[model samples]
Target: MKVHFILHSFNASCMDHNTLKFCVFLILVGLLVNISFAKNDFENCKRVVKVWADSSLDKEIGEDNHKLRDLLFFLHIPRTGGRTYFQCFLKKLYPGYLECPRSYDKLRFDPRKKKCRLLVTHDDYSMISKLPRQRTSVVTILRDPIDRVFSTYEFSIEVAARFLVHPNLTSVTQMTKRLRSKTKGISTLDIWPWKYLVPWMREDLFARRDARYSRGLNTTESNDSYDMEDFAMPLKEYINHPASGDIVHNGATFQVAGLTNNSYIAEAHEVRHCVQKYKILGKFVLQVAKKRLDDMLYVGLTEDHRESATMFANVVGAQVISQLNAANSSLDIGDKIEQRSFPDSDPHSSEHQNSTSDRGASKVTSSESGETAELNITVGELMNSYEGCISNLRTSYSGRRIASLKRISPVNFSREARLQVSEEVLQEIRSLNDLDIELYEYARAIFYRQHKTTLQTFTEERWNNIPSIVYGITLWKVLPLAITCVFLLFLFLVIVNVRRRTLKIKMKVMKS
Candidate 1:
């Protein structure tokens, strides 16, 4: 019909008023078409691009359902209680050979290079492409964005203060080696972010040093705790520093989306340019990061330590239950759930020693063999296992461990750091990290859903997976309908004008 209208209009007199009106009408229609095409396909997709994972297709559990995935990837975002979580949970689950080496500065953690069952790193989501696509489950924990910013800044200063104290250590490698040698093995310093982050921070922040900052260090206070107050940085000055930009910006969003500093998907920036910059970037990042978070089997939270630990046990660690069942045929579903932990005779050792041994055909072993035996907690035995190495995460991570560490760690000073920031500055931090804030909210939603419905049978999980209120419409879908409406309106106007012209021409001929 559009073709017929165009042909009919063109077939009219070249010099006629009807022809001129038709030309103007065509120009207007073309402009509308151009405007529609000029906008990004993602702009309309903004809120409308729904993020839901479906698995209802396979109703029954297959034979392979009991087997573990190829890899368990811990997408560790810094300053999110990741260290404590890794120590308490993940480090216990996979024995040393099965676990990837601790990687902070190194980004390339392909299992092929160094074979391991689990990969834990501070690298962003972009590392997903280099990994084996099949059956690689990812997990991460999130912190409140404002608190995370504060923690990051304070931690950087703490690390820098330590670096300044040891003036002989010129590089992270030297420092890592020194700590490793002093501790006689893999120490906290060996794997911590200070390995790569501290040297640069010392160079950047500590241009001029004062003795008062480190003077009180190593002194036993009234309670016998190390004085860490002198290490704190002013929040406002830290926020303004160029070095702090990556730490304070929408860090969680960028890290989760693989759009962090010096590296980003060009498409995301392009989409931002074509739409409302802040709004569109936040939505684009939230959608992508939310999808990644959904892909993970479990997500922990810094604040909700106990709940996160419980969820991690049920969701990500369920395979351990299956492995235990396979290892011992006499074991019932409700039997004791204990697996082997490596290199730690004492389950709750702070040293948490690792092995450099070859991969074991079997993951769990008997305590008689000298390996650290972890009581694998079955669903029925979860409450009791809360006292063990990993499950102790429920207890230790909740309040006990952090509180104990506060006596010596910088956490004791974090309250003072937070108190220094005014309400306005805190709000400014929120504004800067709006995407991370949104991402964290979505993380909370995923966390809730994992606990609520993820444990159900596959069909039920799929059936309930669709969020009733979250069906997003892509602007891509809206554009076609908009174009159709514009075309119909233009057609109506053209027809009305053509009819008026026909009547006027007939009347003139009749008078002649």
Candidate 2:
């Protein structure tokens, strides 16, 4: 009897241990299954959000009656398609209010002209704060920082080349001349014919060197004599220089955060704080940014310029016309031709003739008549000479001729060239623009969330239009729950069957 009791106790102990082990295993399996289901559910949610967003976007294709009472302030970040936005869309849409000032001090709002609806500027964060919050609606476009920096460099080079080859005018002197001309009273830079071509006139011009140095230096030079103490030296040496403090480092972040001068360093924490005022909350919260972003009238993206332009038109209560396309077509060839022909068409024009005598008089001592004629060469011929200079520089610096500017697409050249950058150099760029990278990521996240929220609202608004059966079932919300409940029931049944089988075996042994 004693032996049987001890054996029974031991068997019971073993059974309890086995049951506990099985329970633990089941618990682990349940946890894993739940995690997997949760992951899948999250992905499904994202897909639903995307679908809803797309549907909402489709509805907004030709939307109307979007005019608002507030003044639109477009914060134009350099090299981020400001030219395209202003030239192709905004200028036509708001001709009365297209004010592009070089600096914050120069930006003037006419209290008398309440129709002043728009102000586009390269002025940084502080400018927005100065405006009446109730009346001002800020809108801006952002780009990949690395790409923006490269584009800035290339654009600076091109503008410098145009300046050097034609008349070798300093940006300040040229601006002074313009200010002295009849166009002096004009508030906006766009009034000038060369408005789009003279981005170098801005005080915050990113390029530090002349066109020759910018185009001629080899960035990858292994020369031992060259100094590498300054970060910007490499950029001056090579066209493909990686990101550094001297270049347009954290340019997007600085611009968005309202830091005007490049002298300011981009500290991540400080930037987060600075942008917080514009954000929904005064803390580092992405949700705040998302909310604020949704409140904006329009946020354009350069990559999606056409669609953005349409959206912009809708917001301003303007008719989307074929003028933009026509304008772009004309700009592509017309502007270049005009710029080249301007000097030649009227070599004896008062503007050139007056300046030529003062500057060319000294250089003309060798051959007076020949020098004067040479100075009167058409822009095309001048550009050819410039190209020859660039070619020679390229050969001297890199031991090979670089691609002609005409062959490269201005918008896409930097993007395509960046892929060819070495991994080490790429890493250096990433490190230099860490704050920009963070800010960009944050902005993107907020943008997506805003997009999702917009879609969700649209979806809810259109809920009644959905078929009764689909609406009644609320399939998107109910399907997952239904599947989960069914799975749990199946699992419960299996557990009950296993328990019953174990109990029956124990009873049979006891009975025997």
Candidate 3:
């Protein structure tokens, strides 16, 4: 009986041990299953983490090994933030690889030497024809024509003000009289005075041109002797003058079409084709202008400068840098004048001299301060004029659909002094610059398309990398907890199995 009982107990003990072993094995299997699931989750996470490998920019980077051999020809339009672009971005990006020759004499190109990668110039579209078309990538920035004209006018005014200052000339009236007196040979009384004026002039009766006016004026000589003060009439007189067209004419088209000479005016009377006769060769000119614009790789807008810079950088395969630094570094006329006029002062001063200097310093300081104040006021007026001109352009294009356009305050005049432009003047400006307006609109459309494509590409690239970014973040947060839970569960299963084995052995001993 005792043996049977012991045998029965041992059987029970063995069964219990076997059952505990099975349970432990099952637990281990469960742990393994958990581990497998976690591993699968981690692997799924890895799939997302690897998304950056599919970036379009990555492809671009890979392809960057192939260096571009084409010369970047920048058509630097005046008053179009070209200085900032050239000095700040291009110079830094290309470093010692930029050539900016202001005159035709310095525009020599040597294929073998290839001294410059970038050729920036104020030279017109005609200049591009002179270069190897296959090897040149032409880029240019365009501004609102009216705004550009205003900026040019203001710049001329500022330059003239700095150099043509007279002690007796307290107001603009006195200054105008002085300028007229000095410029005796330069008459402002002609029916079409623009022909006799400098080619760059954009204001007053001087804005109109006649073929006869170009007969004696040499392009080179006129440009060389061009004086801003010579054309500095009172702003009121300029606006009221019948010859001062309602709006500044197609300065951009003229320059871009390579009509820098007076030939455009001279040939105005000769209609080469009957189709072009209605507007006196206007349609032909427009077609030619469009063709020239089409030849450019990119046409930028000053109004959308930031996007323009990005586009420029992308085309050149350069890392985008802020153009603001370069823009800020550009010296204004005021800064230039200040630098030239204010040389470093002497360090030495005698005690007696100092006493006298102190006595006179207040009077000198007051007088100088008053003069500075007046000059600043004039500059402010010029800036106001610039703003007013821009406003006028905006209003003209706003599609208000009114019979008569409301007149804005006159430029280069005080707020109290109001000037109104006739509808005839406004219509005339629109007619003259119709081609330029069309070109500007076309350029805007192109810019919008290019900008949209670039943005879409960038967005797609970012989305491509997002899965990897999320996976990495998930791994960082969830990995450690998963590992610890697995270890603790494994330890618990081992302990439970050992305890059951010991308890089964004790049961066997008690039975014996």
Name the top TM-score candidate: 1
Residue range with the least summed lDDT across 10 consecutive positions in model 3: 351-360
Residues 1-512 of candidate 1 have per-residue lDDT tens digits of 44445545555633466577777776566556556654544545443322211211121123332235667777788888765555555554555535654332243463443345677777776666556646566778999998888777656555555455444435645866766566545433333344444455555434433443356454332321112233334466566565555444677777777655423344443433322343543565566677677666677788887778776666666675565344456543332223222232122112323332422222344444434344355543542343354444446434644453343344354365456546877787787778888888988887777666655654575577667423566779878999999999999999999999999999999999
Cα error, residue 171 of model 1, in Å, equals: 10
lDDT (Cα, 0-100) at 162 in candidate 3:
30
TM-score attained by model 2: 0.43
How many Å off is the CA of 459 in candidate 2? Answer: 6.0
Q: Which candidate model has the greater TM-score, 1 or 2?
A: 1
Cα lDDT tens digits, model 2, 78-122, are 767665454434433432212323222233333443334456666
Which regions of candidate 3 fall more than 4 Å away from where they truly are?
Answer: 1-69, 100-113, 166-248, 262-280, 316-425, 465-512
Candidate 2 clashing pairs, residues 3+ apart or interchain:
125-258, 219-238
State the C-alpha lDDT per candidate: 0.56, 0.44, 0.45
Scored against the true structure, residue 277 in model 2 reaches a CA lDDT of: 23
lDDT of 3: 0.45
Off by over 4 Å in 1: 1-68, 101-107, 113-115, 167-197, 211-232, 261-280, 323-363, 366-412, 454-512
| Candidate maximizing lDDT | 1
Indicate whether candidate 2 or candidate 3 has the larger TM-score: 3
Backbone clash pairs in model 3 (N, Cα, C under 3 Å; residues 3+ apart or in different chains), count: 4
TM per model?
0.56, 0.43, 0.44
